[model samples]
Target chain A: MSVREEQSQPAPVEGGSSEEFETERASATPKGGEGCDGCDHRATKPRRKSRLPALNPPLETTQHWFIEAITHPGTIESGMRKAQKIVGRGRVVTDGPILDAVDRMRIYHYAYRARLVECLADDYPTIQYAMGADRFERLASDVIDALPSRKANLNGYGRVVIDYLQRGPGEDGGRVPNRRFYADLARLEWALVEAVHAAPVPALDLPALQAIPIEQWGDVRFTPSASLRILRFDYPVNRFLQHFREDKVPSIPRAKTTATAVYRQGFAVWRMDLDLNMVDLLDALLRGETLGAALAPLEDRLDASHVMAWFMAWVRSGFFATVR
Target chain B: MSARLGFPDLGIGIGLRTPHYRHILDERPKIGWFEILSENYMQTEGRPMMILDQIAERYPIVMHGVSMSIGSTDPLDTEYLRELVRLRDRVGARWVSDHLCWTGVHTHNSHDLLPMPLTEEALAHVADRVRAVQDLLGAPFILENPSTYVEFAGSTMPEWEFLSRLCENTGCGLLLDVNNVYVSSRNHGFHPHVYLDALPMDRVVQFHVAGHTDNGDHCVDTHIGPVIKPVWQLLRYAWKKGANASILLEWDAEIPSFDEVRADALRARRYLS
Candidate 1:
C-alpha cells in the first residue's frame, strides 16, 4: 500500500476503551480537577498523594500516543488529552509554573509542526512560492496530520506529498486554489530534489559508443544515468520553475501536456523540456527496449534528422550511463 | 591536558554550514577542523556531498549526526549505522557523535533532539544502544548532552549522573555542549557548574559552544549569532577540567559571513591557550 493509504488508517487504541482510560485519569487527579500547578518547586517537594497509579502501557502504545499528540492539528489541550489517555498525566510532569504536562506536550507539538513545515518548504520551494507561505504552511500542517513522518531521514519525508496532493485536498478538510497547478509544481520540485540527490553514475564515453558495429547498433541497449528523471505534467512546470527561479511571477500557463527531463552532470542539476516523441523514446529506453525497437515505434512520428539531433542532445547531456 | 581516548584535540572549529560553503572552498581559511552533520550528507549524492568530499580533503572532518536517536525505545537502526560508518571512513572522520537523547519513538522521526528521562532504566537502555553503536562503528561512539526545555517527573537522578553512569557502563565518550549545560540548568533550575563538576573529565572527548534564544523564563539552544559570555566561561571551565577535547561552535541559523563565524569559533583559542 502507498504511504498515504497506510497513514489514513485510524490510530489504534491498544488495550482499553477511551472511556475507561478517561475515567482512570480523572480519578488520579484531585477531585477539584486542579492538580499541582506543575511547578518545579512542587516537583521537588514530596508528593503527599501517592503517585497516580502508574499505567505501564506497551511501548508501542506510548509511542503512538506521543506521535499522535505531535501530529494532531487540533488544540494543544486536545493533543495533551490524547497523550494523557495512554501514558497517564503523571508521566509527562514538568517543573515550570506556566508549563504543565499538557503545556510541555504543546511545546513539542509546535516544534514538530515547525520541523515538518520547514522540511516540506525546503523540499518544495516552488510549491511554497506558488501557494504562498500561509497557505503552504496550512497545507503542510494538513499533510503532517494525515501522514506523520515515517522515515529517519527528513529527506525521505516528503516524497509522498505528490501522492497526497493527487488524492485531493478533501482529506485535509480544506479547498486549495489551483490545486492541479499546485500538484504539478510539487511534482516538478520533488523531481528536481530527487535528481539532485540521485546516485552518481559514470557517463558512457564516446569511444565505447563509436566502437559498436553499424549492424549491432539496432540491437544495442542503453542505461540512463541514475539522476535521470522524466516528469509529465498538465502545466508547463519546467517553464514555471524557470520563471520562478528568475523571480518573475509568471502566470500559470493553460493546461498543456509538458514533459521534462531532469538530470545531473558534472555535479550540477539540469532540466530540459521534451516533445512527445522524445518522451516516448526516453520512456521506451527506460523500459529496457533495444535502440531499434525504441526508435521503430517513433519512426512515423519523427524524421531521421530530428531523431539524430535528439539522440546527440541526449548523449551530450550525459543522460546515458552505458550503451551496449 | 592529555587527549582522551587518543582522539586529537583538533583545537577550535566551526560547523560546516551551507552558507559558508563558497567562502570555505575559495579562501581555504586557517581553521582547525570542520564538523559535518552526518544526516545532511548520508542519503544524498548531490552538491552537499560533493562539497563535503572536497572539504574533507582540506580539513580534519568529524561526523556528527542528529538522527541516531540513541535513547529511543526502538531497536538500533543498523542501516543508519552502516551509512554513518561509511561516511566516517570516506571522510576519515576522527569520531562519530550524536545527541544522548532520542529523536523520536517508533519509526517516526521528529528530527529534534528530544530529552530522555534520567532514570536508571533509561540509563541502561541508552548505554546498551551506545555499546551496540560503538561495536558497529568499531570506535568509541560520542554522545552529546542535548538542551532540554522540560524535565520528566519519572527522572530518578540528575542529568550528569545519568550521563556519567552511561559512560562508565558503555565506555562511550561525551561531547560536552556547555551551552546546553547552561540552557538545561536554567530551564530546570540547577547550577551549570554543579552539573559540569559532576561529569567525569576523562570521558569527555569534545565540547560544543553555541548561542541560544533567551525566552525570559528559559533559553532555547538555537545555535544562532554569537556564543554568550556565560557559555564561554563554562567552556573555559570544561577545558580546564576535561582533557584536551576538540571544541566546535555551531551556528545553524541567521548565519553571517564565513570570517565572522570563524572568528566566533576562534574565540575559543583565548580560553584554550
Candidate 2:
C-alpha cells in the first residue's frame, strides 16, 4: 500500500473490544471544576510577591514600572508605549521614530504580543488557515489575552487552548464551551507533537507472551505499552491533522469514530483502530496489572489457541511492556 | 572561545546547539569549551541527554540554564537544583551558570530574563543566593549580567560596579554579555565600552555575543541575528583588556544555516584570535 493510504487507516491490533464503543465522558465532580466561564477576559493577576528584594533597582523607582511594561505590555512610559517602530503583532501598524525605551517598549510589547499571537497561528495554523483570517483574528486575540507566558520559550504556549475549549482556567467564556470541535483537532495535533518527541520503546517479545498456556489465556492480562495512548474525540481530527500535515487547509472531515490507540512503532507515533474492550484493556494494563490479572475482569470465554494467538500477536506487534 | 576556561581548563569551544551538532561531530570545530542548556537534558532519560554524552566525550561541557530562576524569591527551587546537579554529574559539566535576572517569582515563571536594579541591598541578596547555590553545587557558578530596557529611578551604582561587587562578595565569576552591554548601552544611553571597562576585567570568565533588535529607542537583545558591528567593536575592546575569557555566540531565534552560523563563529574567532 502507498504511504498515505497506509497511514490513512489505523493499524489493526488484536484484543480489540468486543462490545459497542463509547468515548470517556467528562465525569461531573463539583470539586475544583476548571472554572472556565468565571473570568471576564478582563483579569487582574495576582500581586507580585516580594522578589529577591530589589537588587539594583533605581532607588524610589518602583520595579513595578518595568515589570508592568514586560508583563502587561502597552503604554508609552512602559516600553511598549514608547516603542512605535513596528513591534511584533498586537496594536496598530507603525512606521519609525521608535527612539528609546518607551518607544522601544511599546514596540517591544507589540512585538512581544505579536510573538505570542504568531506562535498560536503557527501551532493552529491549520485552524487559522481553515477558519480564515477574520475568525482567526478574533479568536486568536482572545486566546492570546487569556493565556500568559509561563515557559522560557514559546514551545509550550497555547497548551491550554484545549483546556479552554473544555473548561476555562478561570471564569467567563474563554471560548471553551463554544469551541467543542477543537478538542479533536487539538488531540490530533497533540498526538503528532507527542510522536515528534515520544521516548523510544522496545518492541514486544512474542515468545515471552506465547509462553503462557491456553488454560490460563482467560487470565492473561497485559500492561500498557510505553508507547500507548488512547485518544477519543467527537470530530474527525485524525483526518484534519492528516490534511494539515500535508499543508492542506483545515477543513472538516466525515463521521466520528470511537477511541483509537495512539502508539509509537519505531520512531513514528500513529493511531490504530480499536474497540471499547481494547481501550479498556490497555487502560487496565497501563494501570499496572499482570496479564492474568488484567484479563480476569474481561470474563470473556475464549478457546485456548485463539487466546494464545491473540496474546502472541499483541506481543509481536510490540505491545505490552511488563506485567504487574 | 580561543583562550582556555580557567584553572581546571575547560579547553576552548562553542555552544553545542543542534545546528552545529552534525558539523561538530563531522568537522569538530576548535575552541576552549561549550555550554549546554541544563534543563534541556534534565528529563528522566532521553536522546537529548544521549547526544550530550556523545558530545561530552569529545569536549568539555558546562551547564547553563534558563529555569533556575536563582534571583527569584521563590525559596530556592531545590528540586530544580537537584536535577541540575544530577545532570551536571551525568555529563560532568565544567560549571553551572544562569543569568542574574529573575525569571519568575512565587513559582510562576514569566520565562523572560528580567532586568534587576543594581543596588547594594539587591546585590547583597543575590550574593547570598549565589553562595547558597555554590554551596549546593559544590562548584563556582557564574552569573551573567542581564540586559535592561528600563532603568529604576532608585539611587544605585552603575551596572558594572554592582557586577564587580557581586564577584567580590560571592566569588562568582562574570559571564559578561557584551551584546547585552551594547544593547543596554544604546537603550539606556550608556557607553558599551565604558560598561566593559568599568567591570574588573580579571573576574570575567566568559563573553556572549548575539543579535538584538534595533527598535529605534532601545536595542533589545533578541538573540535572532548575527552579531552587530558595534558589539564586535566592543568585543575587540574587551579583548584589549588582556583577559582571555571564552566567548559564546548566541543566535537562538530565526536560526540560519549551519554554514552561516559557522561563518559567524569564524568571524568572532577573527576578533578574539
Candidate 3:
C-alpha cells in the first residue's frame, strides 16, 4: 500500500512501543545504581589507585542528575543553537520535567532517521532529486515534527511515513499526493530498498549438477535466499528508481498493475520479472519444502520429466546455496 | 582478506561520513585511516556503500556498527554478521568493531546503544559472543567502549577493569572511543583523563574521537560537531600512554565542507606526527 493507503490503516504494531521499555527511574545513578533494583551495583567502592575513579555524588544525586540529562534540554547552553543547525530542527526540548521536548525529539530523531529515510526514500527522492539540494528535506523536517522515531535502528525511522504521506493538503496535517503514479511508485521503490538490506542467507550450493542425488534432496528443507523479495505495484516503479540514478527527465508514470522480483546478486540487488509459477515456487520454498515436494502441490498436469527439467535450470542459476 | 593485515602502527583516523566524503577524496588527507559505520555500507547498492568503497581504496577502513547490539540476549543476529562480513570483504576493512551494549531484549531493536551492566557474567556472555562474531567474519574483532548514560546496579568492577579483562579473555582488540570517555565521565562525574590512563594500554589497538554535548549536569556523546578541548587533550594523553594506532575524527552531524573535514583529519594527523 502507498503511504496514504497505509495511513487509513491503524497504527502499526511492529517495533512500536514495547511493554517493558526501560523506566530507569526519574534520575541517573552514579558509579552504578547502588541499592537500585533491576540494576547491577554489587560493589560501590572503587579499585585501589586506579587512574579513573568511580563516579561520585554519593549515587543518590548522581542518579537524579543523569535522569535530568536524559530528560531535559538546557536553554541555549553548550553550543545548543549551533548544535541545532548541525543536528537538524524540530527536535523537542520543551516537554515535561521528566523528559524535555528537545531531548526527546533528538533521541527519537537520531534513533529512527534511517528508517524514516527507508520509508520515504522513494516518495521523497523525486523531491530529493528535483530540489537537488534540500527540497525533500522540508518533508523530512515535517515528517520529523509529526513522527519522532521510537525505535533504535536509524533504518527503522519511517514506520510512520505511510501516514505522513496521507495527511490532507491543508496546513499542519495537510499534504498533497502530487501526481497520479508517484505515490505507489515511491512505495514500490522503497520495497526494493527494503529487500536490499533484508536478511541474506547462504546461497544453496548445487554441487556437480545435482550430483548429490535427487533422493537425498528430500530430507532437506530449502532456506529462503536472503535476497528474496516480492514487489507488486500499479506504476513503473523500477523506471522511477532508474531515473533517479541516471538523472533522466522527470515524467509521470502510467497507471498499470505490476508485480516484480528483486534479489541480491553478487553484492548487488537487481530487479526482475517473475512468472506466477516461479513466484509460487518461491512461496513454497519459503515454506520450507524440497523442490519436488513444492512443485507437487501445483495442479498443472505437466509431465514429471518436464517439471524436473525446469526446476534444475532454476537451481543451476545458483540462487539457492545448500538445499539443507 | 589479505593476511589479516595484522595491526597498523599509524596514527589516528576518524569516522568517515558524507559531509567529509568530498574532502577526503579531494585532498587524500594524511589520516592514519578511516572507519566507516558498517551498517551504512551493508546495503548492496547505494551512494553510501559506493562512497565507502571509493574511500576504502585510498585508506584502511574499519567497519564500525551501532546495530550489532552484542549485549542483547538476542541469538547473535546471524544475518547482521553475514552483512558485516560482506561489507568487510568489499572494503577490505582492517577490523570490524561495535560497542559493548545491548540495544534491547527479545526481537525489538531500539537503535540506541543502551548500556549493559558491568558484571562477570555479562562479561563472559559478551566474550563468548565476540568469539562467535570473530568466527563468522573470519578475522579478529574489536569491541569498543560504549559511552553510557547510566550504570546498572550490582555491577562488580570498575568500567576500565571490566574492559581490560574483556580483551584479556576474548583476544579482541579495543577501539576506544575517546569522546565517549569525555561525555561519559562528565555525565557520571569522573575524570576523562583518568579513564584514559586506566585502560589496559597494550590491548588498545585503535581510538575514536568525536564531539559531545553537555547539559547542566551531564553530557551526551553527540558526534555532531568538532572535538571539544577536553576531548582533544584526552586524545593526546591516550597517544602518550599507548603505542601509536590509527585514530579517526568522527564528524557525522555537523559535517563541514570537504576542506573543513580534511582540516579536522589533518589536525589529528598533526598530533600523530
Candidate 4:
C-alpha cells in the first residue's frame, strides 16, 4: 500500500546533516583579493593621485563613503573613486606603514564580494559545481552587486539568485550558458535550503484521520506541512540534484517540464518527482480543498485503490500536518 | 568565582560551529562552555534551533553576534534587539557580545565587519548606542575590538583609548579579543603591549583567541589555523593584567573534529595558570 511498490526506488531523502551545512558555511571565507566581477580592468587604468577624504568627516558620511567604496563592484582604486565622486571628495583611510591606503582598502572590497559569492555558492552548490569556480565566482560577484543584501540574516540572502538569473544575462551576458536551466537548478537548491530551515510541525497520522467520523471524511480538509514545497520546473533539476548529491557527474538534460515535491521529514529533506495525478491531487489539497473535492479531479487518473495508496504514502511521509 | 558583572570565568571554550553539532550532541564532551554566533541561530526556527535547544540544556552558552552594527549612524535595529533578548532567554545564555565595528549603513548590509573610524564623534555615537543596547537587554552588553587593516586619517586616539573611553562612558563590558589585538597591531604597526596597556582590564569579561591569515603586508582575521605563539603570549599578557574572563577559541574555517578544536581551546589554560 506504499508508494515504494509504485516506483523503482523509494523517494530519495538528502541528509541535511549539520556537517554538510557547516562545510557550506566554512567554504564562505574570502577568496583572497581578486576584486569584484571585472577586476582585470584595473590593470589598464593608471593610478591617480591619492584623494583621501578630509579628516574626521561626520560618522554618517564616513560610513556612507566606506560602504560605497567597499561594495563598488570594481577595483579598490575604482571603488574609492566611485565613492569620492558620490561624496565630492576622497581619502577616508590612512596608509599603513607597509601598504598604501588603496591597497589596505582592497581587503574590505575583496571580502565583501567574496562573502556574498560564497553565500550564493553555499545556497546553489549544484550551480556552482556545474559552472566551475571561476565562472561561478564571476556570476556570484555580479549577482551580489545587482542585489544588495538588506537583511541581518544571511540565510535569506541567496533567494535573489533566482530573480537575477531570470533577468537574462548579466554584465558578461552571453557567457552564462543555459540561463533557464541554471535558474531552475537555483530554484530546486533554494527549496532544499528552505526545507532544511523550515519550522517543524506535528504531522497527522492514520489514527488521527481515522479518528474522524466516516460520514465527515468527505469534508476533511488537510493542511500541508510548512516545510513542503511543490515546485514545477522547466527542467528535471530534481534528478540532477540527486546525481549531484550522489557525487556523480550530473548532466544538464534538455528542457522538459517536471513537477517536484520537496519537504523535510524528521531530520532529512526528501525530494520526489510527482506524476500528473499526484501533482493535481496535492495541488488541490494544498489549496484547502476537502478530500472529496481534491480527489474529484483525479478520478479519471486514479482508481479507489490508487487513491487510498497515495493517501497512505503522503501520511507516512508526514506531508500533511493537520486535518479539519 | 566570577568575572565582572557576575559573569563567571567559564574557563576554556570553543565556538559552537555547525560542524561540531553532532559530536557535541551525541558524545556531550566535557568542555567549559560554548560561544554561539547569534546571527546563525537567529531568524530560524528549524533544525539549528532544535540542535541549539539540546546543546543549551547541557552546557553554559554565550551569544556572540556579528550584525549589531553598534557604530553605524542608522537607528538601532529594535527588532533584532528584541529577537536577541528572546534568544538569550530561550537558551539561558550567560552574556551577549558583538563586534564594535559597523557592518553597513542605510539598510544595506555589507556582512563584513568593516573597521570603525576612531574619532571623537564616532566614539560618542557608539557609546550612546551601547548604552541603549545595554538598556534594552537590561544587562551589560559586551563589545569586542575588531581587527582592522586600515586606520582612519581623522582618528583622534588609538583603538585601546577609544575602547577605554567607551567603557568609561557607557559602563559596558569588553570581550578584549587577543588575536584581534595581535592582528591589528601587526596590520597598523602598533606595539601589542601599548594596545593592551591602555585597556580598562576590569571591564573585560571575555577573551577571543583565534588564528588569522598573515598576508605579510597585512593579517586578515580569517580565523583559520591554530592560535599562533605571539597571540598566545598576548593572551598571557592580558590575563596577567587582571582580565579574569572566559576564554574562547574561534575556528570558523577548515574546522577539525570537536576533539581537535576542544584541544585547541584548552590550550588557553596553560597561559592562565
The complex in candidate 4 yields a DockQ of: 0.55
lDDT, candidate 2, B1-273, per-residue tens? 222235354423455565566566677666556778665565424345445677888888877776676665556777778888998887888778888877655344455565565667677778888999999988678888777655543427788888888887888877878888887787667778778878777777777787777644345566767888888878878878965676777766556766676567558766766
Candidate 4: Cα lDDT at B244: 80
Tell me how candidate 1 scores on lDDT: 0.74
- The better-scoring model by DockQ among 1 and 4 is 4
Candidate 2 runs further than 4 Å off? A1-9, A12-69, A73-101, A107-158, A168-178, A191-203, A225-227, A265-268, A273-277, A289-317, B1-12, B19-33
Better of 1 and 2 by DockQ: 1
Estimate candidate 4's alpha-carbon lDDT, on a 0 to 1 scale. Answer: 0.82
Ranking by DockQ: 4, 1, 2, 3
lDDT of 1 by residue, B33-131 (tens): 998888878777765677789999999998888888888898888888888898899989999999977777767767767778777777778888888
lDDT of 2 at A324: 25
Candidate 4, A217-314: lDDT as tens digits: 77989999988988888998888877777889988889998878888886677887876567888899999999899888766656777776677778
Which tens-of-lDDT digit does each residue in A1-324 have in candidate 2? 112222232454321111111111111010112111211221233223323232333222223434345456334443544332223223321122223223433433444444445556645655665567667655656655566655443444656555555664355334443365666666555554443334566655866655767577555555656556677767666556556656666566655766666665553345565555555556676666655666666646333344345556556556666532
lDDT tens digits, residue span A1-324, model 3: 112221121211111011111111111111111111211222233323212223323222322222223222232233334443332333212232222333323342333333333345433455466434354655665665566543334444443554565555665435544533545544544554454455555566556446767677555566556655555666766556556556677666667665555665443555655444555666777777776777776646344554454456445443465565
The DockQ value obtained for model 3 is: 0.09
**TM-score for each prediction?**
0.88, 0.76, 0.55, 0.93
Which of 1 and 4 is the better model by lDDT? 4
In Å, residue B74's CA in model 2 sits off its true spot by 3.4
